[model samples]
Target chain A: MSILEATRLVKRFGPVTAVNDVSLTVGEGEVVALLGPNGAGKSTTLHMVLGLITPDSGSIVLFGQELARHRVEVLSRINFAASYVDLPGALRVHEVLDAFARMYAVRRPRERVAELVELFELGPLAKRKVMTLSSGQRTRVQLAKALLNRPRLLVLDEPTANLDPDAGDRIRGLLSALARQDGSAMLITSHNMREVERMCDRICFMSHGLIVASGSAKELAGHYGAEDLEEVFLKVARG
Target chain B: MTAATPPSAPQALTLPPLSLAARRMRIMGVVRRDFAALRRSPMRMFEVLFWPTVELLLWGFVTLFLQTQRVPFVVTFLLGAVLLWQVLQKASNEISIAFLEDIWSRNLLNVQVCPLSSVEYLLGLVLFSLGKVAFAVAVMAGLAFALYGFGVTGLGVGLVPFVGLLLVLGWSLGLVGIAAVLRFGENAQVIAWSLVFVVQPLAGIFYPISVLPAPLRTVAWFLPASHVFEGMRTVMAGGAVPWDRMAWAAALNAVYLAATLALFAGALRYARRHGRLSRFGD
Candidate 1:
């Protein structure tokens, strides 16, 4: 079953069309990657999906309900995280998670927060203010926040962008496990081709506000007559 | 690689509907986040308690000096005005500051993405402001009684309506400030702090509306705060509670509050359409 269905989404800012006629979907337990170069409208598309931006013309259905009509109800079942956004800097790690847990109406918030703290190895940093954490530690906290509700569909924008290699690899492994074990669908955007190849079930390449090609890693490489996904990305981005 | 076969249709996950109790919990969650910050930051705690005390002391002394000149106004009248004016200031300032804190911390987007509706989030801000206003008022009232022997309770039952009207007016102005920031971004943050002052003189915080020039008096007539302060003066002058003026203030507040709420909703729509919400802090 498709967890999200965004059809023919079009968003324009002034004279520039940021996302033009984009249609995308993510099925249950499937991890879909939206890969594009700068200004290719990936963020704009993700923003629309997250309900942070209103599309000029489009429709979004999440979990078999229209997002526009059932926004509050639908949104309660989904969550999002991004490297560019920060949690409250003054709040301690546990405080931030606990607050969000209550906001999401999670049952037994304290237990849920404790479980996430252990899952992310945040026990040592739980008492530290968010501003005091390193970039890698913050990333872990953010991911932990994203899972507070056990959202059926998770949207991530450069989830591992700020993490060190070891931390980044562990995050990828954990996210893949969540998709396979818990059947949580995800829509992610990343600039790292190898990370995309390892985690994403399918990749969609976008350029200049439009998706130019979409396939599995190997199929995209063959379709673009390139040796790998990185070369395919270069071909699509340059065109 | 070929496309993986799609999973067969599974049972849709059941999501609980948002009950009134649940919505209230979420609103309190917003308030809790703010209180947690205030508890951790000494400067924030000082801001809540210290500034109001200082303002009371400064104004209390000025009122005492004025009493020596045998002015027409009693010490209670002047000191009472100072105390009441702080309520209005705190109500408006705290609301705007609450919103701005989320923006500064880049947490606005995080909150917006959750199930909390815009109405819920706004109510949270208002409730949090009311809490802060209550604490500030208590502190100032106590200091006034101890240092100047002036009691806010001297206004009798009239104080209730007076403070209520001022609070509504403050909320209206605060919503306008929030709308301005939404439409114009952080550059318009000056509106949050300055808008209340713009209405301060017109509302006759320290003087009677009659003292204003003809043109300004006409403008002040429409302001609910002006009517509130005028009613307050009437009570302090040993007259009836001025129900007519209280009614006028309530009626005017209804209109202004409605208009500001609409303005805020429109500004939020504009932000969403333009994608400003995603890049608000940046």
Candidate 2:
């Protein structure tokens, strides 16, 4: 079963169309990467699917329920993490995680928190205020929050951005394991082609608010007669 | 080989789905989280206490000086006006800042994604503001009593209706302030602190509406807070509770609250449509 299905999603800001007629799905345990240049509607489509922004025209179905009609119910089973959004600075990392756990109505919140703490290796930073954490530390905390609900559908925007190589590899490994072991589906956006190729099951290329190309990394490289996914991305994005 | 060192294992844990009371808990959680933020920030705590006390002292001494001129009921009138006005200012300021805190911290998107409804979030801010109102009341009322011999209890049981109407009025204005901040972004943040004063002259806090010019009185009459102050002055004049004025104030406040809520709803819709929700503080 698909964890998310978005159809004909269109969002226009003033004279600009941020997303236009985009359709996609993320199946259970699948990881989908949305690749595009800046302002190419990748984040807009993600925001619409997350129900953070209302599409000018479209429908979003998550867990087989319509998002606009059942946002609260649907959102509880979903989680989102973005580099652009930060937790309240004054809250200790544990407090931030606990608050999200409570907000999501997670079962056994303290235990869930403890589990995430171990999973993300968030031991030493849990007591410190979120503002004090290094970018990599905060990214780990954000990832921990995304897993707090054991979300059925996780939406991550640039999940490994700004992290050192070691931290980045750990995050990629963690997300891959979540999909394999927990049957979680994820929709991720990242400019890092290697991460995309490594972590995503399929890649969708978008340009000017439209999904111009989509396939597995190998399939896309073959489609463009390119040597690798990065070359293919450059070719598609340039066009 | 027999002692391959028995493997150690962690405890098995079970997690049940949340009960129906989860909704109530979620609402309270928003309030708890903001207060948690406040507790972590010493500067915020100092500002919360400092403003009302300073305003009280400044206005208290001003009332004291005015009384030396033998102005009729100057002590009661000015002190009562300043004290009560603080309710409107503090309550509105607290509520708006509470909402702004989320946006300023770049946490709006995180909270919006949760199962918590906007109304639930709003209710949390209202409750938080009410708690702030309680704090301001204790500090300002104590200062008034000690410094100028002004007694808030002089309104007797009438204090309930007076405080309630003003609070609702302040909340209405606060909702408007928050909506503006959401609609206009961080640049509009000053509205949270200064919007109350824009209406202060019209509300006639320190003087009766009768003293205002004709055009201003007409404008003041339309403000629910004006009727609240009017009713308060009547009570201080040893008249009845001015239920008519109080009722007028309540009715007007209801309209204002409804309008502000509608405006907020519209603003949220606009923000979502424009993809502004996630871009706040950028």
Candidate 3:
């Protein structure tokens, strides 16, 4: 069984169906990118997979357990990080990580916090309030929060939106290391096709809440007969 | 000195009550975050401290001028006025800010997505807001004691504890208002405007309840704050305690609080069912 799986997911807002009967899967150590334009239900599908929303119709399973009913059971082995929202700007960087670490109940949490701080190069900013950190630093703190649990399944939405390319590159490297070393699976939603191409083993192009196409980055590009993944994204979105 | 295992490493660790722990952890997380925010912005703490003092000053002066001469009821009224208003304002502002803050910065999504349930969220808000009210009330009491100089007499003791119930009742009402605000957003402003109308005059802040018109007096008797004011005056000024009357007020407040909590829970379920409990913080 996959670490994460969704079948025939649907979400509706009055007359508009935000996520329309979408199904997908992610296995151990795999990285899948949910690609689509704005309002194309990429985030919505992620939400259902994460068990944040009860699907109008369909099921999401994590380790063979249903997500909607077993969110907490699945949640400990899973954690999500996103840039749009944050770990409360008021908390100090160390405090935020300490708190999530405690939430995940990391044994001997202080050592775990120290390890993540060192791993993310977050030592310098530890004492400062999160609000005082720069955007890139905040993203790093968020990434640290997600990893605090040592989650087997990590869902990241636009994980590096505000960072400089250097910071972005470092993050990409860190995520690759996690997947390679820890056998962690991730489902990332990003508009940056180039980053997606570099990080993702497989990509699913979703449009109007359905998976229009699915394959590896190069495979998708060649199958769509486009020069790059971005063109494939544009082609899928335009359709 | 062992060669590093290929990146695909494996290790096993067991978990404890992850669900229950998540709720407690999330609430504690909120407390940590709020306290941190408080420290980072001394200006915000100052604003909270300053506004109550400023409002008290305004009403304190108004009471001084309006009294013509200090009748015993008016003196007692001023004390009740300050205490009761403090509780109401404290409760209203905190509950209002809870959901509004989430919507404001769009952190509602982050919080909702966590393993936080409606019961956990409500418990956190109640515990956190009441904790703030208690601390602020103590500070305000100290200020009042210093400024007013020992005026009222014996058994001024029970008054402090009695005032706590009043605070809870006021906050319960504020919570109900918060529910209405979440399910229907436009009413927030309307509720704000109505807050002043409902609380100030009817709250029996400026005059004795006996002096109010017969119908308004009947209405005032039903308010938990009114009984708190009356009970405080009885203990402080040797006025009548009116146990039967205070009993009724406590009873009414208990019912109101239960109803308010019910409403809040119902509203949450409705929002979730409607998908207005949106995960993206929309």
User: In terms of lDDT, which candidate is strongest?
Assistant: 1
Cα lDDT tens digits for candidate 3, B173-259: 677676776566534645733563475677566555788889998888778777766676666566556676567777978888889
Candidate 1 global TM-score = 0.96
Q: Which runs in model 3 stand beyond 4 Å of their true positions?
A: A103-109, B1-15, B18-23, B62-68, B150-157, B185-197, B208-222, B237-247, B273-282
In terms of TM-score, how similar is model 2 to the real structure? 0.94
How accurate locally is residue A16 in candidate 1, as Cα lDDT from 0 to 100?
100
Which pairs clash (backbone N, Cα, C closer than 3 Å) in model 2? none
Docking class of 1: acceptable
Minimal lDDT window, size 10, model 2 chain B: B1-10
**Model 3 residue B271 lDDT score:** 63
Q: Alpha-carbon error at B220 in model 1, in Å?
A: 1.1
lDDT of 3 by residue, A18-43 (tens): 88889899999999999999988888
Candidate 3 Cα lDDT to native: 0.72
**Regions of candidate 2 where Cα sits further than 4 Å from its true position:** B1-20
Among all windows of ten consecutive residues in candidate 1 chain B, which has the lowest summed lDDT?
A: B1-10
lDDT of 2 by residue, A41-75 (tens): 99988999888899988889998999898888788
